[model samples]
Target: MLRTLLLGLVTLAASLVAPAAAAEPVAEPGAATTQNPISSSFSDTYADPAVLRGKDGWWYMYATSDPLHEAPSEFGLMHIARTRDFADWEYLGTVFDEADRPAWTTGSSFYWAPDIRYVDGRYVMYYTVTDTVAEPGPWNFAIGVVTAPTPAGPWTDSGGPVVAPRPTGNGDYFNTIDPALLAAPDGKRYLYFGGFHGGLWVTELDESGLRAVGSPTQVAIGDRYEGSFVVERDGWYYLTASSANCCAGPVTGYSVYAGRSKSPLGPFVDHEGVSLLDSRVGGTQVLAQNGNRWIGVGHHAIVSDVSGQDFIVYHAIDRNDAWLDAPGGVNERPTLIDRLDWIDGWPVARAGAGPSDTPQPAPTTSSSLGIVSDDPAAGEALRAVAGSWDAGTDDDGDAGAVGRLVPADGADDAAVRTEASAPREPRVEADVRVPTGGRVAVEVADSGPSGVSVTVDDAARTLTVEATLGPRTVSDTAPLPSRFDAGEWTSLAVEVRTGRATARLAESRLGDADAVVGVDLPNGLARPRPIQLTVSGGEAQVDNLTVVAAHQPVTERVAEPVPGDEVFAEEFDGDLDTGWSWLRPSSSVTVGEGVLRWPLESVDVVGAANTGPLLLRTPPEGDWMAETKLDLDLGSGTVRNYQQAGMIVRVDDDNLLRLGDVAIWGTRQVEFGKELDENGALRWGAHLGGPVAETMWLRIMHTIDPATGEHRYRSASSRDGVSWRWGATWTLPAHTEPSIGLYAGGGATPATVAAFDWFRLYEVR
Candidate 1:
């Protein structure tokens, strides 16, 4: 039966150091620290690690170690390691020795693939054991069960195998191995086990834990090997396993694969739509050969830390090593543990040097005596420490470096002022006092866009402002509103954004102040943001100040042809101006607006014999987005037909892209459809399409992209001339564009008319 284990909490301690004496020197900041590998320097031959968290809160890593010494005397000799922070691990002596088991059985104690679960406050271990030394039963190999109260155990076996080899004529009689227990949300228990040649099987375990409830059912089959570790997250169960040969050393290549299913049993398909059971079906390779460090990092288990961070504990053979044999005769294969960070729903191994164990420097305040002032008279040199302060190294190999600064006595509001005329760029340093939980705010003269950034310990904060001459300096403040406090004296830093400047500090008490550490003024311009543009009232506004920092030169440019491809171009030269006759005026498309305007009132329908089929055609067979602005202002009479204008593309005998007016009563309806002729009259056929609501001041856009073979239409309407609601998007299959023109068929009354204005089309490649 499956069980849930809750590990107990582990305690963490914070270390503190004492203040340095006078004249002691300190190393510069940014000094490098050395780190050690957590997994190296251990016994080899360990692979296929099954890591679990016990109730003691320590991580227990169990693996299939050397298989050669599996005799009853060497059973349970496989390795185990315990760790708390995942950095330093305590090597636990091997606790299991098969020879210690009762002499009632006839098998050797060779074990492989060990798994541990905490049930009923006891630790239960399951492993595959085979009797190569003696033959006492029909089965050569079987799963053995043992129980212990603690992970480091003197285990008591059940005296016999829990699962024996299947009898002849049974479907899965070949081999039984790789057993995994899964606890479902419904509180039921299930067992899954299988191997390379025989396939995987699942069975429900009865509450008593000794028997299967029913006959075992075949879950999956084929060459998919069975180091299956099943995990469920977000309502889906994921079965992760290793594929291909894993123990051939460097020459042996293996990868991890996974498949997900809504249920725990049956019908598992890979991302590529192939059943996992099929020999040809390949699953996703989550981790593969990545340099020499992680040549083969599969057949592993995941262990979650107290903070819920998951780490992958697996065995990897060094590329330099050829085999498990070593000078000590102990396999050199070592178990490696690395933090796995999730990105886009997939786990990625963090590849870098391990974290350092050295403590960081403390943030310094503004009033301590050790603070150094660049110039006592000029005052340009501020209480800024050089960037070379080292926290790890001690001066004279015994104590840290110190600086001293004296504050002017008496004056309640004492201030240190610096003249602008110092070195081309000047800086200041002064020790300022920081009360516990207190905040410091420094006021500087408004110089311009130039600014300064302050750093407390390792954290940095920036303030932008200008600087002025004579007493106008930038001050570094401590206990800033957002900074968290550390108990001891820490380093404070100030860096100038632009131009050289000097500074000084004034505080209430000089003795209680923290050391003012470093100040640096580097010459450079601030970063800029480019590509900022705004379009309004049919005009494009550009800003030159916005500049993009480019690592590589952007040389590719597009040239605009003088006369581009005109899919549908019309001048409306004829004078039939009534609805089909002449145009009526509206606010959107005004004849007085100087652009070609189409009114929104119904009138007589007029068409010349030659221009009856007024349509626009493009030379290329491609998708395009056409846009046009129109103003519809029908003051009196019924406004219809031309009130809503639309465009059409890919017109065929049966289907065409039609978007525009199909009005009923006084409301204007905007729609796109596949035009079909029922009995000579145009009719919209039902498909994956819909209609849009008509509005005034409309800019309609129709887009076509050949890559997707879909034509889309969008529009925006405005009432107060400011804000606009871009209408819904409609799409259709790409077809050839032959004719495009204004169609005003329905009108509110007999003599109403609609007008049109200017239009433009943009094609996307």
Candidate 2:
């Protein structure tokens, strides 16, 4: 679908200026630090960014056809940029000028969402051809391919659409945009395409990698996803796609979600086992707008550094100065980069801290560790030292044969040492299955048993790591998450780098960085030494043993709300506070016994029909957070369209921001919605955030955007009111002090009541 262009009334120059200077910077993981909007130094609007490392060793990024930092008149072609260090970027101009567009396209056809890859021998570029001359229809989006010698691209079109437009018989059609290619492990080139219309899909490509050779399979449902990017990792194909409104200026709720399946063409599912095609929708949040300066974060590309550390490059709009000119103008989406940490088999940006507004450690551009890899399954890297070892197939036949070591004779420890030399800043990883009451230890950079040793105990279900050097020892022991079963083949890794050591465990055969369990090893040994594996008690089978010197920096950050002094609060001890006012008052709303209760009525404050009852109170000026604990039961796994109850920030009946536990179709979601006047019409849109429960705490963090004089409200919810899940942000126009309140209405089915424990507002510190 062609994105609705909300043209900003402002001119080009003002939008190109740098963002507001950041406050005191927060440190990141590496030696040199950088911040997000990494492309802002070069271009202002680099949307739908696709990044790849070139043969020239520079990382090149391509964007949808849009001006770098100017009016539309300056654009009719794709944009490209290059970076040596992600911290510094240089504009490389368009991939093709208007005069060089494909001959099959009309003058009005636009190119978008470039997917670049080095296929076979040369570089291949797959992109969206909107309004192709052959289709002769509006929104005739199709996938097109172009060949180039290198990433810079002196290119040539493949002469036809790779995937043609498929009309759905009605006036509507399935969109064939946002092309992505994944080279599967089985040597098949799978092309993933489609958008919010017709959903995301995957098809096998011909050996030439230019045309689809098979029928497509849907990866995600329509109306929920677009801009699909798939990556295969550790036997799982993870499909990441952008969701929600992509271009709503400052109010844009564009975010990224992820699902994975073992098959390239899959019934992909989220971590919860919910299929992406489910009516309720199932996707793990990958990148969403936190309460930072950046919003509308989506359409991402993942790149791995030399050390195997991953980075996510995407685009985001500055909520403060969102548009290039006026409110509905071109959104200023600058490219952003953050560490992509895999926690418990899922990829989360910056270890779940979301996007960074402060300085962060730059990507490790150079390898500081000199390492080697060894596969113990081949029995080539290890020699039995004090054990009776045998090579045999593991319990899981899919994992192939492994080295099984058991204590021989009367010895309590069975040990094997690697033939390769020790490594600097070493990380030792393996897949192992330990018998009950048994324990397995992986030691790296060892000086006898005095280096760094990670032990996994089956009976206790614990992961213990001890780092010792010259009698100084740093040790930590943590119980494994319930998912870990030592009796099954599990992936484990232990690493020591830069005076710190971390140990990780995954329940499955494919190694997952499940958790970050690290300790400061001030006197730890990082010098080169042979790796050693030992088993005691019973027996343990190990396979795929890999030892590499990875000097990886910690990337996870803890998210905490910064609250100032209390501003306003309602405890509902007896009756409504004198400071409160009611809009469309309802008899069902009652305050007593320390709780305010209201039922889900048939009325609502959506579109032109604004009849829902709201208990409103004016909030303090400037930044603040409004929180409410709501207990609303709408049942689950059933159709409960629009029934909701939670907090609301209201301007009038048709203009407001709402955070509610609402039901849509068959799913229960915490929806953060915004209703506003767009071109004299009432437009309502919402972005789903954190999961929802019957009893949940809803919070809306409001901050003033100094640049645009806009109000930014970000949603967060908590099941236990302790660890909050921050979601997307919605922007409201300036000069309006919206009344903060509570609203419950949408459905009257079964007559359910919403009990709110308390309403509290705090100044943002």
Candidate 2, lDDT over the whole model? 0.74
TM-score of 1: 0.40
Model 2 superposed RMSD (Cα): 12.2
Model 2: lDDT of residue 551: 42
Give the Å shift of residue 621 in candidate 2: 10
| Shift in Å, residue 360, candidate 2 | 3.0
Off by over 4 Å in 1: 1-39, 65-76, 102-107, 132-139, 167-173, 208-211, 326-332, 341-765
Which candidate comes out best when scored by TM-score? 2
Q: For residues 145-227, what per-residue lDDT tens digits would candidate 2 score against the true structure? A: 99887678789999989998888888756788888887653546788898776788889888788888868888887767888
State the displacement of the C-alpha of residue 590, model 1, in Å, after optimal TM-score superposition. 73
lDDT of 2 at 595: 94
Residue-level lDDT tens digits of model 1 in 1-765: 000111221000000011122211132476221122344434434566766654333556666635322122232355677664444567675646555743434433445677676533356666655442233443355566677767767677777655666544653244566666664433344566665555667777555343356766665553444566666543456666655444434333344556667777756654544456543333433443332333434566655332223455555545456243322223234556544434334443331111112332111211112222211221223222211111121121111222222222331122222222122221222222222332222222213444333322212322222232334344433322222222222212222224432221111111011222223333342222111111111211000010111111112111211213445433344432332322232334334433454433433222111111223344234434454444433332133334334454434434444445444222233333334333354433211111122233443355444466555444334433344333333344445444333443334444434444433454433
